[model samples]
Target: MPRKGMRSLCFSSPKTLAYAISRFPSPSRSTAASLTPRPSFNESMIQQTIAAAENMIVKWNPDTSSFAKVTSLFYEDRNEAMEFIKCVNGLQKAMHLMVTENSGSDNLVRSQNLMQIAMKRLQKEFYQILSTNRAHLDPESVSARSSRASTRSSTSDYEDDGTDDDIHAAGDCISEVEHVSVTAMENLRLIAEAMISSGYGKECIKIYTIIRKSIIDEGIYKLGVEKMSLHQINKMDWEVQEIKIKNWLDAVKIAVKTLFNGERILCDHVFAASESMRESCFAEISKDGANLLFGFPELIAKSKKSPEKMFRSLDMYTAISENWPEIEFIFSFESTSAVRSQALASLIKLTESVRTMLTDFETLVQKDSSKSPVAGGGIHHLTYYVMNYLTCLADYSNILADIITDSTPPSKLHLPESYFETTDSDDTPAPALTIHLAWLLLVLLCKLDGKAKHYKDVSLSYLFLANNLQHVISKVRTSNLQYILGDEWITKNEATVRQFAANYERLGWSHVYSSLPENPTAVIPPGKAKDLFKKFNSIFEETYRKQSGWVVPDSKLRDEIKISIERKLVPIYREFYDTHRVTLGAERNLGLVVRYAPEDVGNYLSDLFYGTGSSESTSLSSSTSSSNRRQSRSR
Candidate 1:
């Protein structure tokens, strides 16, 4: 009897109905009942029509039998079909004792048992039809039927369930494959936790079984969703979603294994998860969970072989930022330790990928010097390289400490070390860039000018306080000896060192400026105020001259520099505040900012002085540029 307005359209013959019916209600999908055919065909007709029908059961009512054939004929031959059936049956039997539900939740074992019983009866019915019609069915049709059944068996969880397709299509709604995947993982997670909380120790096993069952039913893997599985495997739009969901699920499983001790036992549960990521059509997503299975080295190796693969990786990495809400949890403290660790680890892998991508992009850009020029003249990949590095670094930094993030320690060559270098070539002329960087770093640790001290002074001071600071400077400074020892480099430098001493003495007197105090006291560590003054006086006396002698010898020039600092620069900077600093009496203490040398200390206030934070300034800046353009036009 068919429904009033419709007939059940079977995927194939009614013989396969048992297999389809048996595999309903996948682990991830609770909506299995909706996939059943309406006014379905007779089971015997389907079995008789299919080519390889001997092993494919076409009929049987479950109320009559306890055993049913579960073999599917998708692969080929009756034996192969029987093997598939035997394997699933054995797996189901093995899974019987695997998991238990929490006290408040429904008993998973009972539910599983009931599911298996339904599966048994349905399979038996299918077995009867296939066996009876073996004489009429063709090998090709049997194979096709078997494949469809097998695909629906365990892998169908990710594939289209007939019910969802029509309903989803009617609504013009897209299936949130990724969301559903994450939800499935989360559900598994909750169930596992509840099982654990309920003192059921086999929770991991139970969750594993549930996941396995669901995956097998879908035929798409929990760990790996191959590209082969996705070529119009479902609706085109749904394919990508399926992959993403697979990725998230894969991520969850990794978290579970690493977070728990089951690290060694994969059970291939997350294999589909891995495939989901590695097999993604999008490069980034495909590469997303790759590091979990293949080391970054392999990716690096593969990327080298295939530029196309690498390009895909680059786009994927760039797109991840678009989903900040999902990733934001990456930074939270509440995330499971495993999830947080994986997030951080993923960043390191990403960094490596970016580095590799840039390396290749560099080559591509260079091979065409006759073409468009980019910045750095060389292959710097300036914009994207820095962007990739910074984004990856941010994720890495939150998980790791900031100390490692600071590139400025003795750890580098007092020599400016390249981020990476393959060879030390003597032919390469020594770049002065290293010395300047060294100087910049040195200034950060010390009070460069007595009048100016760096902000975060304590942290700043610590950079130098440790002996490594002096050691690094000394090591790097020694490298400059060839220049320093040269007649032109230092023949007069000795005299300059003496002059610096004299200059410091004259400058330190403070008596020269009647308005200024004779003694300038620095605020120091509370208990060591006296020692601080002593140290300061010595620094002005000895270090000011011999320490790192950079100033040119002109007393009047020093005074002029001081005058400029007080009169024009600082005053102009303060006036831009739009009266915001007016009521604050502490503006007097604005001198604290002056505590830092112009360079080392300017970082904190750089934006203050130059940032287009104010609307007025932005408009003025725009006008200035426009005015300059007009003048140029007139000229």
Candidate 2:
């Protein structure tokens, strides 16, 4: 019969039970009777005895009174407990014998049904008592108690009812009861693994919480709730914390592997610890470092210290970066390439954030340019602050270079040798992101350059653009950025400055040519020379009046610009003068009406920019007319 069919026979009709029992082998009733005598009691008496035995056996079920009564009974009659164990074992054997001996009898099968129920209940109760008692009994104590019980059962009038195998089986059940703590941990591990496998990272935070609790309970980390704590301080404290964190990290690694099916877990503990230390350092430097990061010109200027407090905050970031190797070494077990790459990436992010502050400042200054003139010292110093910060970045050139190399695409890695300035032979090196940095720097300079055009005077606008452009090139040359931008880049920008000078010359001198109309006939109308000279004087006075207040700080740039203007205008003016003088009187009033020789026109053009004379003296309509005539006589 199938096991399920046989189990059903226990609850089926008596005929069915007997039929199922008869299919199995039968044992001799006489041999079982010879081993133990049959009871002389009536059926009621037998049922009563079974009930009393049930009452004596402690049920493991929480609903029963027997659950609460084992401790005292086991403490008082240890030998009696062993006798009860033997009694349950005999009941189990008797049920097996009944199934074999009385297979064809309906009455025997009914009796056997009752016996099986009693045996199962007795087995459950017996194991429950054993489990409850095992916590208090060591292996030696159990062994000693069982031996005494065995000797007492054999020597006294009681019979030895169980075989050695039955006793050993009972002992095994008792010994195998698991500890509550171990069971709880195992359950936690299984649940955590399930949670992690499902990509429930937030839920896994509970696992971390549990691990932290365990760490605290294990005394690995002290609870610092008290005011007077006993934890290690300073460097020693850090060492202790690192050790604890490493231990927790190992546990987390196993948990991550279990949950994520063997994905590598980054040691974020190292990064997290480093971030904590860095934040503390940053907080100490400036409570408002975040504001400084976005470039507060007022805070920087208002601070009484020599350079600025913002500069100190800037240094703080660099200091952390310089000392970053110490924190990076926390992951020394990881691959060097990975660690350094991560470090470089973090540094790049920091540099970009700092640069963002400068960008914000530039935006502020640009907005200010629309409302104010370009000559304020505040704007100038703010521009200097930006340049100074860019110079500071050269300190991290190697890290920046690596970042550039890693981000560059493979096809164009080796740029032309001429694109970068290097000390060695002309082998083209891999192009770097430093070139991008140079471009960004140029963009910032151009922002200020464009803002310079807001000035009312055209010459002032050129002067502003020239000064800022020169400042940009000089700052780049002095810094490591020069290697990235190359001599070719500088040469190109220098040519651009010369172009601006040429443009300015064209704008100023274009009027002079327009004043003298094309006289290709080589003749002048009567009284036309006087009208032409007056027209020329009107255009010259107007040009110099507008340009007189415009300042060019660099004397060399000023002189070069004036010479360029003169080269274009002096020859044209002289040719017009010689042609006009022949048609008019030769010596009668030729020098007086012509007004300016070539040398006098050159000297007047030189005075066009600021610092040539005082404001009243520099005006061509008033003071310059008389000075030009005296100078004309000398020429």
Candidate 3:
């Protein structure tokens, strides 16, 4: 005998239900006495229950019902659908009582026939409600409604009591869109519970997975996620592949956050009675699309590794990495672990590709064999390219940190500890990206040093280093690298630029400085002074002609160099010229001998770094006008 209040026997399938019924326990004498119907329970009541259920169930059956032809049973007549569900429930209880009394009775057979009709009507209603309310039950809308409902009541706690109480409880709180969704979801839940309880879970699962899987597939297609093989990806041109990568980056966010999340919520709500069914249905619908979506990055990673392709690869890695928590939760079932594995595989492959590209970039920098020096000792082409690339790379520092955290610089490169210090904390090691960027710059500088030796004049070589280093430091300060590498690195590199400039000044101007006496105002013979002046004029003209063609591209550094020369050379020459012009006043060719005034020296120094090397007469004329202006200012 079945226990009291036991609704019905659940069977795995329709075929198994008969076998299960045949094996039903026979009542012992004491149990039989307890199992007897009360005064209210009788043969008339069972007949009435079965007859009422048959009329309603057959009237709405999709095959025979004229009303179902014109309108859906659930949508046009929700109260009828509720009453129809109650009839099914009543029939199950009556069937259970009759089976216990006499399994072979005619009334028991009639009750089984009515149960099949009720299930068919429900199956049709379930399909009708799902098909008609697609917009209301769309994953995005359903996810949103579920989110709001969960704030007040847990979405997972929904129970189908064969009533409209869930809908009524939520009617005032939700908008019309949400109300429609709640009503449809509640209907589906009722039908699903009735069918599963009556041994038709397979049929219910089939209808649900077929409809929802199509929706998911269509959503993925509309989002522009495509399926492609690795050969196709590898053979495609980078420009076209780049566009694909960008689209994937955009589409992945929508697919994970909205499309898949909504489907999961709907699956859980529809099959709340069976946890295994919920997991199975969600996995069946979502797994293939998700695997394809996440598998794209793995194909991209396996494509040709190039320095240019690294950032896009990182973009794909970041898209997956940022959304991983959601992916883990939504696809958490054991059946959907392939989706998780595929996503993780993409991240791992992208990390490897990026690390390889970084090494390739470093090697490219080290092997840059452009032996020709920049014509005017200005910034080199390699300097501009690498700094610009690294500046852009710094924009992805946080992402790159995860990629390169375990990767150390090569042992042979031997980077210094001070190179890794940050402004915020000196003791804390700099982030991997900062160290990596600093290392790349070091490689560029070392390569530049080798290229510097190509210059015939050692002084111009030093000038090249100063100009290029200044450009590097300027790039770092103006971009994201400032926050990554910090102020101490800038100060240290700036000091290097100053040191290079000092070496350039000392070596390049030694002759001019030597041409003057140790003491500019020392008393001496006029004839000896005239000889000293002639020698001074010869040396200054030659040095000025040569250095005027050397360039300092940075305006601030150029001005500083000019001011430095003026401070060292101008005032002493002016003092000496004032002392000696009177002594050599009456000598013939005195104009030819005292070739430059002190203010003329100031003017010529102004033109030193133009890289123009203008004619001597043009320089002298430009200098004379500049000298006259200075003289006017003095007066």
Candidate 4:
């Protein structure tokens, strides 16, 4: 079934693939070498809080049914505990009930409200918890300012002298560490809230300072991860897959409340960190030190089960936004435009890189093929990236079209460098195909009803690009195929690309246009013209209709192409034939102009290529049949 330019694909979800860790079982690698543990300023306060939370865990374990399973999580059976206490408050689950329980008995309801409030407070102060400690959730926090003190409250805890400030100041004297485990952070939150709800808000400063100076600076975060044995790693692998069995929404809601709590101090820190990482990445790209992508051998790795167990707090939420950008703010209830916009900006960058890759693949292929020591990377990489790029854009197409319509930028979609600037010419300034320019074109395309439709827009772009590519492909001489697909030439460090044209007879392009007779006087050689004809045949035969998948073009499309050539090229060629007479013979070759031809022609030669003038044109016209006969014989 001959067809052109269509491929029907049936894709499967990437999730079906299984993932495994590269680490060995019971591997005896030392943590000190792999982890550069740092201390937090609040280390002492946090440790104190954790110790207190551990005590609370011991006390609460027997009675706390809601968190009972969590507490026993690190153990194979029912009785063990990991070192850190986690926040299994299931915080978001409480949001609706907090607002709805307003009509109940003030004391009875308030106590419940306080517990709920305490959890909210707990998550805020503590941050994220380590999975190992998820079962024994530390109290996330205490109520903002409780009216009634806990019956078990300490007298010194509620002291109004602000004396804890001195202890907090003392935290400055301790050595610092790097990275805090979400688990350790959660322990601090529970302790701080417990103390405050017990009437010790003034003591909060000492707690924060203790954590900052000792734990944050010292890096308890790195240590917690480093502490994980091969067994723990293996356990984590199970937990990720098992999350689907639990109420995932419950976990997500809790996370949203904590991360989006609108803390001025913490928000700023997050912003600073994200911006710094972005800047560093950009600078590295500009400097051309991106070794992982280009020079190094590529790895085919899939995400592991329970991937979230290993993600940082910020990444977990942001990834949700990436997958569901349209409903992100709605689901998380984060009304801040800056936050939403930041998410969108991140999505935009991701989309742009994806766009760059999809567009520049041909160039990459050509370059890779040119290398002397070829890297035999398979089509799997290309297929994977293309499908990923398309899937992401397709999912977000509605959001993108909406944004494009509203933005003042001339184009709706922004493209990377490789799209318009096909040539990095020395004679002129690099052609302006900047990202902003591509956006202008996208904006225009978005306004078009056809392009605004799903899959239509992408297909429209593909066809348009393909058409222009055909023009460029047509202009390339068979001789210049070497220069055209540069990388492939370099890979062999040889002129193998020329073979795309050179193997015409063997490849059958030569046979397709074998009707043309020799005309050495023409600007292009008879051989070259025949090859060009072959290339035209190839665009349909070898390149398009020959794909390994489904395709069928409309009959009218083929007919229209024939009609177009009749209208455009046939008349043009007719005029050339009438005026040029395009006559030549071997007798004119042999010595002066042509190569060592007629000398070899003496060997029972049929004929040789030569040009003809006015009288020669008469002879050429009269000899057209004989000339055609000679060309057929040469064939």
Report every candidate's CA lDDT. 0.30, 0.45, 0.80, 0.28
lDDT of 4 at 412: 20
Put down candidate 1 lDDT per residue, 1-635, tens digits, no spaces: 11111012132233333333243222332233324333433434322322122222222223433333333232124334333333333322222222111212122233333334333433332333333333222222222323332211122132232433532343343234422322222222322322222222132343344433332222323445333232333333444543543464443333223211121112211222222221121122212232242232222223332233443343333333233233433222232334334444544555465445534443443242232321111111332232243233334222223222323222233222332232454465333333322233323322122112221223212211222222222333344432322333333333433443344334432322222222333222332433332333343223212212122223433344345334433332333222222233244443231232223212222222111233222221112243353454356
Clashes of each: 53, 0, 0, 77
Please give each candidate's TM-score.
0.22, 0.39, 0.87, 0.21
Better of 1 and 2 by TM-score: 2
Across 197-233, the per-residue lDDT of candidate 3 in tens digits comes to 5667778988999898989988888888899999998
In terms of lDDT, the poorest run of 10 residues in model 3 is 151-160
Residue 545's lDDT in candidate 1: 25
Give the local distance difference test score of model 1: 0.30
lDDT of 2 by residue, 314-363 (tens): 44344435545543443333233343344445445544444444445434
**Candidate that beats the other on lDDT, 2 or 3, i.e. the better one:** 3
Cα lDDT tens digits for candidate 4, 58-105:
443424445542333323221222222222121111212222332122
The true-versus-predicted C-alpha distance at residue 409 of model 1, in Å, is 11
